[model samples]
Target: MKDFDLVIRNGTIVTSSDIFSGDIGIKRGEIKELGRNLSERAEDVYDAKGKYIFPGGIDAHTHLDMPFGGTFSSDDFNTGTKAAAIGGTTTIVDFAVQPQGKTLNETIEMWREKADGNACIDYGLHLAITQMNDKTREEIPQVIRDGYSSFKVFMIYEGMMVDDLTFMEVLDIASENNGLISVHAENPFVIDYFTKKLLESGKTAPKYHEISRPAYCEGEATNRAISLAKMTNAPLYVVHCSCEESASEIKKAREEGFPIMGETCPQYLLLSRDNYEEEGFNGAKYVMSPPLRDKKNWNYLWKALNDGVLQTVATDHCPFFMKQKRMGLDDFTKIPNGAPGIELRMALMYSYGVDKGNISIEKFVQLTSTNVAKIFGLYPKKGSIVVGGDADLMIFDPEKKVKISKDILHENVDYTPYEELELKGYPVATFSRGELIAEDGEYIGSENRGEFIKRSGPKII
Candidate 1:
């Protein structure tokens, strides 16, 4: 019999703290050992001669089968998780929305039903709060104790935005329970007024999407959310931060030693407002909230990530087909809000953020995998390649070049904004829990291997 289940030999192991040449041995589903050279028999062996072995990525922000303006996003848990695995991400923490008038518990149960048996990798959820009441607040502590420790409250979105009192109530509940609260920080009132005015003036093109949700709206809400977090002494994470204005707000809050974290999506780093001007209604494909801003904002976002003001890079991977994007052809308000990106997040971030020298390789590990696990309460076990941890690994080739095309992507969405964009790096192999699920752009794993992961409490780093 083999001494181990699997062994990856002669590889450059990269972790958040160190990079060394070693062989990693796996037994069952956990990493069994790592050393310079070990004479151990194994059922299987991969000679990763010159490749880099890193922990499989963790995408902390994604919207699989999310309901949005008039329709639902295209990818369900099965398709979304498959794409994530092919992209070298072994885990994802998607959102569970508390629909209006419903209790948080009800929403969580509903979300669990949607994700059960459809995932190919491990998954967790962050509760998105749209309703805050005595019952909801009372349930918060119990939910935290039950392994759902993070909740997201929005400052924008009509009918979804919470009032100041409710926001404060949520903050208090989270603070008391040691739960992290994430915010979609944009002033909905401002956006509503601006969007109404823009519609009145006959500005309904995709470009108007950006015009309606200005950067100032994001900055204003970011600043307010930071203030609320400071007052309640709760940790806050701003999701999908887009502009320099909002980045500055996070930087200021962090400078004061506040427990504030921020994350920016891949669209904000690679796409720009110009993408909204694509000929015809094609631009509607990029119409996510906190719309992609001017190219100059990229520098500020990178700086935030490098300086640690922004701690994670996630794909708000809400995908919709091109035909669905046309739902708002005459009126931009009716268009669904999201874009497909989970499969491209790590590659694009690595190519643009690390390969370009904006951040070091270690930082890439932190932003893409480590910090996400740390924030969502699944660290050391899922995010790193340490002994006794889940054997999730990826073999990456930094020099390989490939061009992104929507036709070849696995997202159920019919189009990709990054189509034809040249990228210099790609993952050659991906493993989740000691099983090889992807190799050289081909999927090779059993379906429904994923399990629903519950947040057990605040991450024990």
Candidate 2:
């Protein structure tokens, strides 16, 4: 009789701290054993010679079926999570927004209804706090107790931006309740001034999007957010950090021993502001928040990842179709601000970040998988390959190459921002809780197989 449900043999298993060649034994949806040449019989076995086995990546930032700019994001949970698995990510922590006048529980229940029967892999939620009243403030501790331990606050968006007092109140409440606050750090007023000046000058083009939101806008807001966290003695996480100016502020705060963490997306590291000049509206595909900076900022962010200045790399996977982008044909501000990247983060990081000698294989796992889990309270359970942990993993072929194109991708969008970008390493198979979900660039899993993860409070790593 087979003693295990599955056995992955002859694979080089990797983690954030070490790399070794071994076989893994899994049963009942959890890792059962780890050893060399495991002699136990199994119902099924996969030979992974010459391939690398990595713990399934955990993307900490994603907006699935989200409403923005008069329409919802193109990829809903079903398509979004499938694309994430095909890209080697087995779990995702998506944002759940609280509409005005809605309570915290209502917000979570609404998002749950959207993802309950559609998500393909395990998922969690981080509440985006839009309204902070005496009632909402009272709900923070209970919400944290209910397994959602992180909340988001925007500094720039019109309906989402919180004033300084509200932001401070959030920091204070989260600190006392042991939850973490992630911020979208960009100064709205500064952006408004620049945008007004550019529009009056008749510079209405996609390129003007980058011009209206400069690096300083992000830098100033980053510093201000950090200062507020310091005053409240709260831990803060700055999301989608784009340029050296913002990274510099984060590094300085960390040096001063403040509880601060920073994350940068793959778009910021691989693309540049010049994308805004992509021969007219073609640039609209690259229009995202904290707009891509000068090419010079790339190396600094890369170096920050290797030097421990930045802790995680996430996709900020929010995609919109070209039809939605064309809404701003005459006015740059009307363009929906997001691009598809959930399916490209892993390969892009491996090709440019690791293959180019910018980071080691271990550090790659740390930035893309391990640190994210640790920061967001899913470590060991979702981020590590260990006995008793969930059997979420990926088989990566290091030598296989693929040229990215929208036709070959699975995202429910009409175009891919990473069109024609070749990548050297890619995931060939992905497993979630002992079930094969994706293999060879195709999704083969059953619908509604993913479960909602109950996460604990954040762990300081």
Candidate 3:
């Protein structure tokens, strides 16, 4: 008889704090032991001699089977989770949005239906409060009790942007319930103004997407949103912050002790507005909201990542194929606003941020996994690789390389924005609850193996 269900041997274990050579023993899906050596026998054993064992990534922001602008994103729960697994992520918390005049519960039920038997990894949901009423406000506590510790509100979008009063109420309700709020910060009026001007001049190309949504629009809205959080005395998380202007304000707000947090995506850090200038319709692939900022803003974002202004990194993993993005071939406004990135976040960040000496190993773990767990109530359980923790881990090859290519990637999309961008690090093996889901860039996972998680109330680390 085996002492444990599985054993990871001779691996360098890296956690939020320290790194050391050791072995991990797993039993029934949770970590049973961790130390230099163990004489236990197991039915399955992995010799991780040259790899670094870390907690499997938690991609807290993802949109699988999301519908937008008359078309649905390409990846459904099935393909997105598989891509996440191969990219070293073990779990994802996708957004659930209520349609106009609908209840939060109904939307969650819809998303749950999509994820129930299709996802190959654990998942959670964050309510996107698009409209509010007495009933919506009343539903807050139940949502919190149901393990959804976070909520999202949009600052810009026709038929979706909540009023200041609604935004403030969301802040008050979430804070009162120990829940956090994430805002998509962009000035809708500013975007409307520029969009009209650009089109008025016949500037309908994809490049105009960035031209209309400038950094100032995001910065102004960020400042405004933080001020509202202060008024309500609520904790705020600004999602997809893409410019130096926004980071600077967030830094100042944090210095003033306003309980504000900032999040940015790999696209903002790795790509820039220059991508929008790609010839013909090629630039449409990079057309995400808070569209990629200028190269000059890169310094500030990188500094913020290391300087404490930004608290987390997420993919906002929403994708649309070239054909979908081409919906706006004659009108930029019709372009679907996202690109394929669920599979490249880890490797791209490691190759760009770590190998370039921009952030320490511990910081990388925290940004990609730890901080997300702590913020969304999955810490210690999903973020750490320790005894008594879930056996969700990734064995990474620090020297392995992969050039971003759609043909070889698994985002269910036809193109990758970072095509030909080579990364020196990659996941060799990914395990969720001691079950091997991916190995050496190939998915060996079982369908419907995922379960919905119960998250704790909001609290920051």
Candidate 4:
């Protein structure tokens, strides 16, 4: 009998904490051993000379197949998860929105129907609570017990925004029941006031999207959310934080011993408000919630990531075709609010953040993979490469260079926001549970192999 199902030889193993030159042995979809040399037989062997072996990425924020702005996101689970694998992410926790009159159970079933036989990689769901009633209240604990351990509440948006009372109740119940709450930290009133003023003044351009939603909108709501989390003694995760004002608030709250964490995306850290100035209706492609901020906020977010103030980096991967984005041609408000980055997160972090000296390689791993898994309760199983952990791995080529464009990606979208961005490092191969699903940006995986992960409570690391 073979000593292992497969053995990867001669790679530099890297985790959030350490790096060493060794080999990884895999059997039965789990890591069986980690050591230098094994002369024992194996069914397959991969020589990964001069490569870096790191745990597969876990994107904690994504909107695959989700509905927003009157249309469905273009990248459904079938394409989205495969694109994520090509980019080195093996798992994703996507939001399942509860409609105005739907129960949490019904919402989960709807999302399950969308992903059941489509996904090519593992995934989990976070319920986006749109209504709060006595029945919903009673179901919260049961949902947590059933392994749906994180809930989402929107602080903005017209129909999805929860009142302060509902937010407080959700926080209280989530904290009491060991679930965590994530919020879209932007004040709706502020957005409404500025947007109405801009449109009334004949400023209905894509540039006005950023003007209507200023940095302070995010700042004010982030502060309020942190205060609410403190009052309820619960952990709060601020998603897609885009400005220095919000980062400062999160930093101060964390320093004061609050269980507050924030996530920032590459568009916020690399792209800027200037993207909204692309000629004509072309600028609609860059329109997203908490619109990209001034370039000055970039370094501040990078510093926050390095200093532990911002603990995670996620791609709010909600893609839409250019035709869908053009619905706002006459009015910017009709533009869909998202961009595609699920296939670019790893390369961007590796090239810009690590190679550019903004963050260390270990810090890169923590921000992109390890910290995400820990906060979402998949720590040792999904984030690390220790013995007995899932064989989710990425073999990276530190010196390889790639020029990114929509044509080169697997996401089911018409445009790429990071078009023409050059990168010095990229994933050469990706493995999910011992299966080589993607190699060199080409997918080799089967559909519906993904299992819905039943996660435990938030680990708070």
Q: For each candidate, how many residue pairs have backbone atoms clashing (under 3 Å)?
A: 1, 0, 0, 0
Off by over 4 Å in 2: none
TM-score of each: 0.98, 0.99, 0.99, 0.99
lDDT of 4 by residue, 1-461 (tens): 88789898899999998999988899998999999785365688888899999899999999998888899899999999999999999999999989998999999999999988898999989999988999899999999998899999999887899988899999999889999999998989999999899999999888899999899989999999999999999999999989899999999998899989889999998999898888878788899998988999998999999999999999999999999988788788989899999988998999999899999989988999899988888878898889999999999999998888889999999989899989999999999999999998898987678889988888775
Superposed by TM-score, candidate 4 places the C-alpha of residue 328 at a distance from the truth, in angstroms, of 0.6
Q: Give the alpha carbon lDDT tens digit for every residue of 76-159 in model 2.
A: 999999999999999999999888889999999999998999999999999999888998999999999999999999998777
C-alpha lDDT values of all predictions: 0.88, 0.91, 0.89, 0.91
Q: Across residues 1-461, which tens digit of lDDT does each residue of candidate 1 receive?
A: 77788899998999987899999989998999998565467788888888889899999899998888768889999999988888899999999988888898898888888898888999998988888778897899988888788999988787678987788889888878889989999888888898999999999998898998889999999999989989998888899999899989989988888888889988998889999888999889989998999999988888889888898999999999888888999999888899999888878888887788888999999999988888888887888989999999989888989899987678888888899999888888999999999888777899889977767555522
Q: After superposition, how far is residue 272 of candidate 4 from its true place, in Å?
A: 0.3
Q: How does model 3 fare in lDDT? A: 0.89
lDDT of 3 by residue, 1-461 (tens): 78888899999998878999988999999999997566357777889999999899998889899988999989999999999999999989999877898898888889899999999999999999999898888998888999988999999988678988999999998899999998999999999999999999999999999999989999999999999999999999989889898988889988998889888889888899999898989989988898998888877888898987897889999999899999999989999988878888888878898888888888888888888888889978899997888999999999897877888888899898889998898899999999999998888988779999989976564
Instruction: Mark the regions of model 3 whose C-alpha exceeds 4 Å error after superposition.
Output: none
| TM-score, structure 4 vs. true | 0.99
TM-score of 1: 0.98
Better of 1 and 2 by lDDT: 2
In candidate 1, stretches whose alpha carbon ends up further than 4 angstroms from where it belongs are 459-461
- Which 10 successive residues of model 1 have the least lDDT summed? 452-461
Lowest-scoring 10 consecutive residues by lDDT in candidate 4?
36-45
